[model samples]
Target: MSSSPQPEAELAKLRFTLEAANAAMWDIDLVANTVVWSENAEQVLGLRPGALSTTFVAEPEWIHPEDRAGTLTALWEAARGGETYVIEHRIVTADGETRWVTARGGAVLDDDGSPARVVGVLVDITDRQLLAERLRGELAAKDRFLTTIGHELRTPLTAILGFSAELHDRLSDEELAPVRDIAQIITQQADQMVALIDDLLVAGRDADSPVPIDPHQVELCGTVRRVIDGWPDEHRGSVSIDEGPVRAFADPIRLRQIVRNLIDNAIRYGGPTITVRCWETPIEGRSHLVVIDDGPGIPSTPPEPDTGVHPTGIGLAVSRRLAERMGGSLSYEHVDGTTRFELELPLEA
Candidate 1:
């Protein structure tokens, strides 16, 4: 076996390995206010690779103008306090093209404990930035499509519901039972369609520009009362509430959504029995708004196609997200002959 390699030989091997990985090395002389770069450094700086001295000629000219201030600040901090840092920024290439790179380095202190030099490596990351930008564009396009579809659907649905309501008013309940029933069905289904469209539009909204959640102490009983009262006549009587002065700290809009979604899901999927109850859980210092229905409980495995009931879909998932966003939690359990969904939230202090 060959003798152990010398320290100088090992350092040379490390430099070679870095260059092979497309990483350029940088060394800054703090006292001289000058920088020395490896041959590959020019490549990362957007300059022809042969020029070793091109880096310090004018550092800002090599960096993207928008990134120069932040980059210089990082470089200065490393030199001043011997701080190690990693920064990702764009560089302007000689061809006027912009490329992303990440630089990692720290100050090298002298014998007197002063910064003698700063050293680091730079690696290209343009591909990652391009992929992120592409994903954002695709998401924005999807949001616009949802908004356009909502506008298109609501226009015709409003007209159908209005005309059906007028006709229902004109005919006596005893005159044509079939025709009266048809008009009532049309109105109810159209209203449901409108609500579904609204929820779809809400889902596609820009998360960065979300309507701010405005949380405050709110009375759950009154909100439930209004929501139940607004349900279609046939479905309204099935829902019963025994909530009294139940209070929680929550965003009103989000609370309304969570309650409305639970109520609607119960009516559509819950077999025949449903109830809304609210009470304070003193042990947890929380308020529980519970919706109980006699539907088959959530399955151990998702339901198969054409089964008795499909699993809860996007609508309920969104409601769960909203509840969590407001410093609250939602849970589900199957009690004797009933499926219970409880929305647990903060009690007003």
Candidate 2:
């Protein structure tokens, strides 16, 4: 049978593990004003082995200038029976290079309930800090590119739509039927481009910025009908509107956008059958507008992480955001072989 290892052997193994993890254990004596470090301290702190002087007073010099005062205050507070000391800050190594580290420790009290010492660990986190900074920079660049492209495309689309409308009005005579058909097609395609540009602009803005809303009393049935009628003829097939009309206190423009996006999503991914319904709930004077389809619903699991594009599409995500910004909510449910997306809004502002 193998014998159990001695205490000294276990200590050596623990020191080896800490060194491999880019960490060092430390102990500080309050009364003696002295510090003791594991043998690997020099490696973690970017100094030659045996070059460090173990004194509590010398620690502040190692901390970055901006973090020195806060670090000292936290240590003093921990000694006075306060919370454990935990901080992530910059440190200046002996090689004159700045690095990020997280230090965590707690005070050890004596029999009289006074702090006699503190023990802690220092972990090098320079790689993690650098990675986070790079991600932020990439996100900012994406937002700027989206905003610029959205504005540029919108300018030409607006001109194309205006010209198409003018041609349609001037060529209304039966003799010019072929020319009028071409103009109508141009207007329809231009309208779709405008909607896409709106989504891009929304994606470019800061998420916390409030969406601009102008609310008023609006009839839900008419708004929903208008959006459906605007769809291209082929995409409008197999859609039926249920016969109850409801009113809501909401932004008409945003309501139209939400409705259009939902219908487009259903047409792209759902089964042939589709229905739109509107009704007032019995309690709270709230109303619901739902889009239903007979198709296999979205997967139970969430979309994959870090993919940028939503699984269903960006339209549904934008619709959900707009609904909440207008004091409403959008939810989804898959039940009894049918998928439903419901939007609820107040009857009064």
Candidate 3:
């Protein structure tokens, strides 16, 4: 075997490794109140070589004012025989620019089992931190835009809905049948627009939180029937339901949204015929509604990497979220060349 490496060679190797990783080594002597830094410490910190401070106490001046106290406290604790610590804080450069850095350190003990020095490595993370901040800003801006547009659209939509309803109620006589039909159509379309805007408003809010809902006793079959009836005449002919008397404690509006979205997905992506079935499982004391279609199943693989595009569209996602918020769950499966979406809910006693 080759001779063991000399101390100088080992130090050179360590310096080379640190340089490759864009990090600098630092050591603070507790008893002497002094600090030492590797040759590249100033360079890593965006300062000219030999310009870095050597005094242990003066190091906090380089740290951002908001983070100086916490950083100093953590280092002091580590030097006082505390456990190893890792901290990410902002550092201020000589030119008043702020940069993020991650520091990791531990105490080095003397023979008496007391910390004699605190040693650590510092790595620059300014680029990564800035990128994360920019992304967050973009998301906030997008949410604000969506919320504003949704509210603006809703104002006109509400007026349309109110006028259409008033006109429908006023023209109930048989002689003005054609006008009443047009008014009814306008009312239905405006109501659909309201639901769409509501979805947009919800999307503009924080997604991690569950969708808000108000739940009450609901005649489940009637809700499902209303969603089916709302479909256009042409597509409505292709849909059928096995309507059983089922009661559920749920948000009727959101329940209708879920049902309508499922049916719409089926009509768009599924086969020509669609079937909906609702029933209560006595043993489980829960109610379930299943929408089945004979169309091709969801694609086995996504079309593009990292693109979370659902095969059917965003409606399924919204419907599933609403179902879960109302103490129910929506799930999908493909069996025997048939695609089935099932919604399970708590049964109203």
Candidate 4:
């Protein structure tokens, strides 16, 4: 038979184990008005274990000023009630570094059910707390970016649309044609800019607003035809939309913008013939809308611009942003000397 451990031997063993563990251990004797802490406590709190001899009460001064009173009050209540106490708080080390820690304890009761002692464990949670704070900051930044872009784009777009409409209404037949062309170009460019701004906003907001989209049921073919019809015949080049209408549940306006931007970019950078195809395929229980184009093809790397804007690259970026917002993705592939742009939006059932 194994012999039972004496009280002193058992306590000594516990002290040894606590000293070896990473966590800090503390014990307070209520009646004796004294306190003892393991060596690890000094490392955790930046205080020598034996430096404070009067009482453990002053040790709470190391806690963050904002949390010290509340923590002490809670612990006192738990001790008075002969119950367990658990709390997490911030403390300042001797070097003045703030660290997060979780402390848990239970009251040790006398034979008469009166509280005589309190024992507790303290663990550093600084790393986990910092990570959580960083994530919150990132989310707030994204929200701010979306709101700012929306406000900025609306101002310029309103002016362009209003002036173009007024010019179209005021010009005479002889004077109208040239003025009309100018107004139309202004309107088209303004619309494109607004669409790009919206896409950027969408990308920033997507995490919070993921909506189910159905690409198979959306009238994609008609949307493409309409966009092409809006372009002048000279700049229109060879445009083709497959015979069948493909349906998708993506925001109709955003989808149209994606198609228009791609086709516009192809005409601006590629040869006259621009082919647009829309189709749906199921992938892992979701549907996708794919738009391909045969353009001069995106450069292996983005070009270094010396002066003017590179509309093709800008348009592709906008399209990708929109696709991501609609719970989808956009990608490019070059095959057989043709550059293909694919926009994939999740299908809404």
Deviation in angstroms for 298 in model 4? 0.6
What candidate 2 gets wrong by more than 4 Å, as runs, is 47-53, 72-85, 109-115, 200-256, 263-313, 321-329, 334-339, 344-349
lDDT of candidate 3 over 1-349, digit per residue (tens): 8999999999999999989988989998888988899988887887766666677765467788999889988987877855688999998776778899999999999999999989999999988999989988887787778768988998999899889889988997899999998998998788778776766555445554345688888877678678777555777889887855787889888898888778878887799999888888868878898899999867665543443436445567677777777778999999898999999998863
- 3 or 4, greater by TM-score: 3
Off by over 4 Å in 3: 1-21, 29-34, 46-55, 76-83, 107-117, 175-179, 200-307, 321-349
TM-score, per-candidate, Cα-based: 0.77, 0.69, 0.63, 0.56
Better of 1 and 2 by lDDT: 2
lDDT of 1 by residue, 1-349 (tens): 8899999898799778867777788887877867777666776566866645633554567788999889988988887997898999998888999999899999999999998999998998898899888878887777777778989999999999899888877778586878987897898789878777766666555565343478888888777888767567667888888856888888887788788888888887686777889988767878889999998766566644653233555567666667777778888888787989999888864
lDDT per model, in order? Answer: 0.79, 0.83, 0.81, 0.72
lDDT of 4 at 313: 52
Please give the lDDT score at residue 253 for candidate 3: 80
Residue pairs with backbone overlap in model 1 = none
As a whole number from 0 to 100, the lDDT of residue 218 in candidate 3 is 82
Each prediction's total of clashing residue pairs, residues at least 3 apart in sequence or on different chains, is 0, 0, 0, 12
Sliding window of 10 residues with minimal summed lDDT for model 3: 303-312
Clashes of 4: 12
Worst 10 residues of 2 by lDDT: 202-211
